[model samples]
Target chain A: MARNLLRAAAALTVATLVGCAAPSLQVAEMGSFHVGGRTVTLSGLPAKELVFTPGAPPLKLDPNGDFEVEALYARYTRLSNPKAKFPLLLWHGGGLAGTTFETKPDGQPGWENFFLRAGYDVYVSDAVERGRASWARYPEIFKSEPFFRPKKEAWELFRIGDTDSYATDPARRRALPGTQFPVAAFDQFATQAIPRWGTNDAATQAAYDAYVDKVCPCVIVVHSQGGNFAFNSALKYPQKVKALVAVETSGSPNPDTYDFSRVKGVPMLWVWGDNLGKFAFWERIAAQQEKFRNSLVRAGGKGERIVLPEIGISGNSHMLMMDRNSDQIAALIDQWLARQGLRN
Target chain B: MARNLLRAAAALTVATLVGCAAPSLQVAEMGSFHVGGRTVTLSGLPAKELVFTPGAPPLKLDPNGDFEVEALYARYTRLSNPKAKFPLLLWHGGGLAGTTFETKPDGQPGWENFFLRAGYDVYVSDAVERGRASWARYPEIFKSEPFFRPKKEAWELFRIGDTDSYATDPARRRALPGTQFPVAAFDQFATQAIPRWGTNDAATQAAYDAYVDKVCPCVIVVHSQGGNFAFNSALKYPQKVKALVAVETSGSPNPDTYDFSRVKGVPMLWVWGDNLGKFAFWERIAAQQEKFRNSLVRAGGKGERIVLPEIGISGNSHMLMMDRNSDQIAALIDQWLARQGLRN
Candidate 1:
């Protein structure tokens, strides 16, 4: 009961933390593109591959065919006003696709449109083996089986609400108060959930690295789990990244091991929703991020940590980029980018 | 950890269930009024009271002073169109006042304006010893110490979100995935959380009964703990209650003891948000109400249970009346009232 009380108390921060004011511009153009993939040649004996179809003959293929791996898919939305200095690249976290920056589940426009409207060309991408990038079969190129996120894990790890909220009994699901994510369209959000593997990092990193090489000298917006790639990418090629915007990202480049001097000129912004200290998961994430930020600062790097509540916006969850006030936050980001000289 | 999972699962219903369609007509004429209060007379000892001032001498009352008890306060918003067949009386639940029907904490208009605009004279009331109906001193007219709802309990019991969402750490608070409550203005919602006591039921019941008697043959919209009084009052005076709309109510009159036949002609509507089965507390309330409804049906009573998600309206919390789409819900009730043949 005491724990329940504490849990209840912690939930309020989720409701009252993140928010936005309004928008000043609108989108003018939207487009899409794909980049970064490699074909692997097989030298061993021929391997059999079976393809099944409904009410049709199955096709069998021999190992003579090469497998395509580590391809990245991207969609670009360019604004007519062209106020931003360069295109903004949006990188989604693990198990998610470029759809994160596209239309919302509730049919509202996504951040891609909002940023475009705010005068910046926006590029949303699907990392290797995710979304439109497509994955290769195991034992050939990949080593392990891909694991899917259970609905329960999504509700908890995503901080949608509490664990009990996803109970089979419809009545038990109580959302934390003040959550801004469109809970009604959660099914839409869940539709974006895909299979992921822990062992795919090496290939994924390679694909992302290639993507950055292609789209250098642009602003980067990274979400949960994508933080590591964004940080490492920015560190590896500092001249390519103008500014880094990390939205509730889960990982970062090791502050101790990474070459901090590389990122000294790159301004980074870490954004957080409400209720960080309450949940053990979030508390740990926040602490580590803070440490990372401190380390960066100690190394004479420039960065800012923007907690939503500190700016009078409240009740935002981790998915702030897809929230009802997504545009508002996007506008705020636009303003932040302008301050960083990444935008006009 | 399992319990936490359960809690997280239970919290989802609070976000995604219970909703309303958009309103077809916006209110045209809007207005307000206040009424209902009385003073108690004493016989033997002289009743004297003293009033304190900030920078002046204290004022004293004479021995003829009388205390006021069980005086309900009501604010009536009359519509010029008068499309409804009867006046609508809004009764709030436990620990809350008539302000539930007023302007929303998020600065959105409350149900009072919506109903009035929909063409009903909306009577919003503060039950005895609550809101404008000021409580008397303990040991005199009142008994026992009143307990206040902590912000934490409000977040939990109210189905706002998870515990961590309320943590003081700005980063820890995460709103549920799909909550529609105006989380940004939660402080305003908390302001309405006044002191309440379990022992005040009798007096509250009497006051409610008296108020119903004063305004008979009206449609009643009851919320939360107010369900008990609304049911009993309707049963006791069947002809006075034209119809009843109970929104996320916590309690109801037992079917075994009550004369169900008395309420047979009084149509009732029970509305529930998402996730009743997730939280044990709400689960019990929902079960009991279901049983009560079944009993009413057995007695040949006409009643309908409107589970938000079952009907396709999702992402509503327990405080549906205070949600972002509150007006839409109000319109739904209006449609229901028309279906009941109570609207013009």
Candidate 2:
């Protein structure tokens, strides 16, 4: 059936390419699914009338019901002839969805495309409560009300600007000197930020574990908040996880509390972009993640940490995948994967 | 630059095609952005401690802030050489995101892929407060609390099952006889349902108008509740909307209230699946939409309505795009587009 589809796709390609360029990649299949959510029933909430459309009579809005929330949503694209040993999963960071790995805020092709071009089936996901992974009623299924990430917080905390550099006016918001982030598209980047609950880590972790179980024996490329999930998933399912790529992971397993030996056999790569020392927050995060990496290495694990500046690459911010030199960074990761025998 | 990228893609294709099938299609550019949102500030909300991680100390969660909300999120893929004269914008319905057009509940490739393969640049959007377009604080930025769609409501209201056929137990649930919807995947279909608000039609419509302004002189394929937005958009920007394909649109502008002549020059196609008349609710929706269609035709507009049974295609549910015969339905739409001179 797969071969037949490929042959048909090839024929369609010919018919469709009359005046077009040859497609860059031949996809065998593409699809998406929601995984790992449990149902929760709520009652006693007041009912109201909902005007679903203008001029239409209202429909009864009943709040007492069984709702399914906290599922992880993943969309995958598989190449007809994949060159990688395992599929690559792109997981986004805090307050963002899988869109992090898609198009950059500056409207450039993102890592999802770059990696697909480099010959791996790609799966991009929205972790629990983010993007298409719908959020539950706050203070109901979720323990706390969701928190919104303000544009100022994103600018300052994401290492795009100095502590006092973010201003209400766009013209006054100062980016770090020589920053690689597209400062002109800062507002565009801010739009991807969604409401995130502070207490859903366990739910998020469970959904991610379900996701890993559903589609693994694969590679996971994680960023920021996703680092914790990837590390936990690897620790929990070492055999299924082929490798780990952490991009400036913001949090990590407490090296003193968790066992790192389980992932010692899993090849790992940690990448940090430029301008890390500008903020003590990033410095702290880097230090904590470095300790975890060190612990993994100390346990006889094969792990490599790449600080872009050390390799003569500079001026990258927290959003390396969306940075101006994102392709360069992806190339570096691709080379590392190739060295790890991930390529066919 | 495009030529260079295409040449480079072609070169890479050659090197990568050693044992792999040729890629199904070539992509020239892919990207996403959020559009049409205004910033709002809130104050006097209480703060709390947020336990972001399992073992970490809680961070102070301050609710007082300025937030960017009610934005529309859209992702676009432009082919290397698109075969359509204009790009195709896919607008999803209520309680769902662009994922509606992505992958079906049964893991099948969906209309997005079908259209893309048929040679149109596809743009799929999550309307305001849906999917990647984040929701705002209810009863604050929004006028009312968001409502959740229960699984039972979906099964009955979407024409997947008889009104009394829904059961709490999966094994006991009964699909309408000969329904094309994959009954086993009904639970999977429910996962795409998100929290939809009651009083946000204005916000939703405004965001959609802004979206049309940003990305039109193109075709629009809408589903379910998206009918209202597409109709309003065509009415508002008649020249920009080359054509419209509305599948099971749940609501329409009251023919008595709105001027239909505005869209007289735009071609329109309304598709209805089988089993629509199984419930009075669906019958009412179809009748309302049919009246609007009739009004369009009476105004000298070019419009066609295809009831699946009338075309000798039967056993379809309201979720026609996700039905077993989804590809056949997509093929029908493609043929219609070709006949309408939408093809290159």
Candidate 3:
């Protein structure tokens, strides 16, 4: 568990850059849909589909006597690149949806584009109760009202700057020197922010697992809180996931109890951003991930960690996909995918 | 100096959102320029001007036998909004250039547009030795060679995540859950990275002051390291700056002995991001800024601290201007300006 395998392996990355080739791009298909869950009885209330039409009235059609509340919203963009070996499934973190991989808050193309350009058939999804994934009423089906993330929590927890800085007026908000987060586009970043409840994790995990079952035999790219779901899913269906890329993920399978040996076939990678030591909360999170990765390797599974700075790349935040060099980071993944033979 | 003003500001800030009014906008003017510096002699060689033209050839012209090395590169955008306010000058943090206020690496319109749309002419500048601002050979004209910022240093110092995370693989990087930074675009952020030398601070500060002098009676928005230049400029020419808005500024006027009353006539605003306590480095920075602000207030200057979180707008990083909600932050500044009667 305490091995510094990298220093001696010679594979300990020194310094390098991802590919910058702009291949002939072609989009095969792009659209969105709902996945997971079925109707269940809720106090004997009937299950119904509610439809709202713009410039028109709302309508409700009841089919089953059971309530449906856990279907997740998802969008997939597949490229017609003949060089692609496997489709890449993108799972976003807590309080956010597939938008995390779509267009940036500042209007730039997201990882979906980068991966597609790199010959990936990409699938982006909104977990249950996030983004396009509609949520049921709280205190009824949800059991608890959703708590909105104030801007303060983000400033403190996200490592954007000192927590006290965000407490200042918006005009006075100071970014840490050399910070790569597009501070000017913070409002745009917040547009992707949604209300999240601690009580929804179980439901979210279930829906995500179902998503994996449906989109198996594909590579997985998970971010932040999505890390947990990806880890759990890979454990459940190892053969389906050829390779796993976890970006700034916070969740992992319980290292003490989980049998990581099952995931031995799946090549796993974990990427991190700049300043981790600044935030006390991330210490435990980092430790958790390290334990999980170590457990996998000890069990004969392959795993690698790439700290942006250690590799000579820096200034990335938790939202690396939206960072200025997101394309470069994607290219790094592309390179890794090729090495793993996950790329054609 | 250790006062927790936010906790006491319950009545100071309630729940309120920045303006979201998208006004009819028009581009009145846009152009770039070089500002400040005098010709200087280096060694025994005569100074020469070297110019490079696209699709043509490079030209060197010797005129005054003196070379100008530290003039900065600047871009100005003036919008034709009839409901105009005082022009705004945006000073970026250290190691960054005018691009900080221009288009985001993610391709979103920058704060320059938001300010222009809000009826303020804006000037974005690349300090000397940064961006388009040309540099001279070290030990000849300049004293020391520039030092490049590695990826690891950026990750830790910038507060993106833990160093261990970045040291993993690029794909394995894990952002803290709930962070507002665009981690995907980290490579994009790295693209802006350049070599910085500690010896150049004075020259950079001098160039910034000169730029302010050239564009006087304008509102100033300074971030991080730019805080030093903004404070010094305001102190020297308080009359020229109708108002000063320092965003998460770490540097300040010499609080111990400087004449704190000289700039009392100019209205000032100090803004901060969230989580100062998390980063130990920021504690002193926050303290420095707080001490300076208090001294200014005691000197009869009108100033206030706007903490983004204390006001319910959380999740902003040091680079608040490039954040998704940058426009909202700008709107807050706009509102404050109107209150100060800075509007035309």
Candidate 4:
């Protein structure tokens, strides 16, 4: 018995070392690229002498030149042995970059790792004017100054707390009851937010279209503002889009104006988290999406919605992908994809 | 003996499964933030209607608004059990973002993974007007329009080939004999290059200063144009900066104008690749750096230079980190860090 216990201890040590040392997946290919933007020229601007470094002589700076703006950047990781039928694309929302799907603020493995482990080639994109997709000059190329989101606004808008619950002091801020979001990491989440423009929706859509043209026959998972782009892309290229999964989509196409019949063959799933009914803003957005979904179903399209609280999961914020039960949600997504015959 | 062999096979199978299932490291914390940009307001721009989606009516777009511009973006990964005494910050060069240290154009793991595996926390950054650090309005806030680098220009400028070696046709372009850069992935490397403004150097330097102030008493690894910022930063905050590593630094302070004595106590390393003598531009740059290095050493500074070819490691281009022998060079840096007493 003593010998058996010693052997068990030795086996446990080896197992622990192996578990900490190995990588989660074997990556076959990984790289990044930019797609879709036009070049613009600016001439007749004045030249100036500027000091680039301290104690150095000023150098002449020429202002007239041609520039490239509004391009979309995408980074992809293809697995050595993928189990899915098609590649997966993860898109982020307003004021955020492709980092939305990366490691979470609380140091947890995000959906990117979860999906990669589940066996899919994942492509995460920084759309026009966001992240590595550099922005254009405002009032000339971009047509407007960029807008910034304050921390207070994010605290309320993300459904983490009621409007009155937020305070200047962290200790005073009260999150919704049983919130799944890692409230302690709220400041960390805020760091991912960047300035966004109100006038570049058309430019952003064009870039997303170009991205879809470059890479298609793939599945798309979008959140918030990305919903409009993914929805429009699927409508425009139904044959290329295998499936669409939207998490708390902030906006959708107007069903009365757009043709839902164009995407009858495409399967789509809409996911919503808990405490959505606590605010009128979310209620209005939900009503609009419900109307759009109803129209699509009537037009013979495969559209489905999953409300987390109704299905026994609770206390999730709008940023559900970063929530505590994020893995559970990812499992549901994997199960849904398999049911749709997406498994290899 | 047969039973013992059977047990061994079972152990091997278990190890293999565990190896493929675990992550390389346990992360203690990971997140990102933006730093150093002033707010500006723009007015009197024309309002326009934007067609955000196909078959939908145009939405009104107001161009007048307050804007935030010229901020730098930084992402960090802190290991649970760090072996290095200080965090490592990786800064990129002109026309490139933090992606320079990520996956290589050829799909092999880049320096980010290499140093992470070496047991140090890593911080990667996008300097002002690059990547997630969005650009400002040209001829207004920026004072110059951006400049784009043509593929042929990058081919010659990066020292992958001679000026006469670049061609419009891929098959015709010739790399220098025994080049270590993955010539086949040349086109892929071009994707990371973004438009840069010549006039924004001051803004860029200011942002870098802000970054250093926020994250200091740290080690810095810089490449190309990043050389100037890293050098200036070290000179200004010598106590905070433990060491500086410059890889193929394209620019440096004039030893006649700047004082190198400020960094006398800080250890520094200047790394260079092969075939630098093939171009007069590179020769001039090398002379400047050599002068600066000599001045630092004369000032009782801990300065060292490593020419790859001199060390029997040849065939490297300006982008040594992305070259095939990148891991070998990383091992060299690791050894240097150990020698500096940075190993925990």
DockQ of each: 0.01, 0.40, 0.01, 0.15
- Runs of candidate 3 with Cα error greater than 4 angstroms are A1-24, A43-66, B1-344
Minimal lDDT window, size 10, model 2 chain B: B14-23
Instruction: Report the number of the highest-TM-score candidate.
Output: 2
TM-score of chain A of 1: 0.87
Candidate 4 chain B worst ten-residue window by lDDT: B14-23
How does model 1 score by TM-score? 0.46
2 or 3: which has the higher DockQ? 2
Query: lDDT scores for all predictions?
Result: 0.68, 0.83, 0.66, 0.79
TM-score of each: 0.46, 0.90, 0.46, 0.72
Clash pairs for candidate 2: A23-B25, A23-B26, A24-B26, A25-B23, A26-B23, A26-B24
Residue B207, model 1: lDDT of: 75
| Residue B91 lDDT (model 2) | 89
How many clashes would you count in candidate 3?
A: 114
Better of 1 and 4 by lDDT: 4
Residues B176-295, candidate 1, lDDT per residue (tens digit)? Answer: 668877777665566455456556777777778877888778999999999999998897789999999989878887778988888999999888887666578898989888888888
Candidate 4 chain A, poorest ten consecutive residues by summed lDDT: A3-12
| Tens-place lDDT digits, model 4, residues A92-147 | 99888888888787877677766776788888899888878867655667775565
Interface RMSD for each predicted structure: 28.6, 2.7, 25.4, 6.0
Q: What's the CA RMSD of model 1 in angstroms? A: 25.4
Instruction: Give the distance in Å from residue B285's predicted Cα in candidate 2 to where it truly belongs.
Output: 1.5
Off by over 4 Å in 1: A1-31, A43-58, A169-171, B1-344
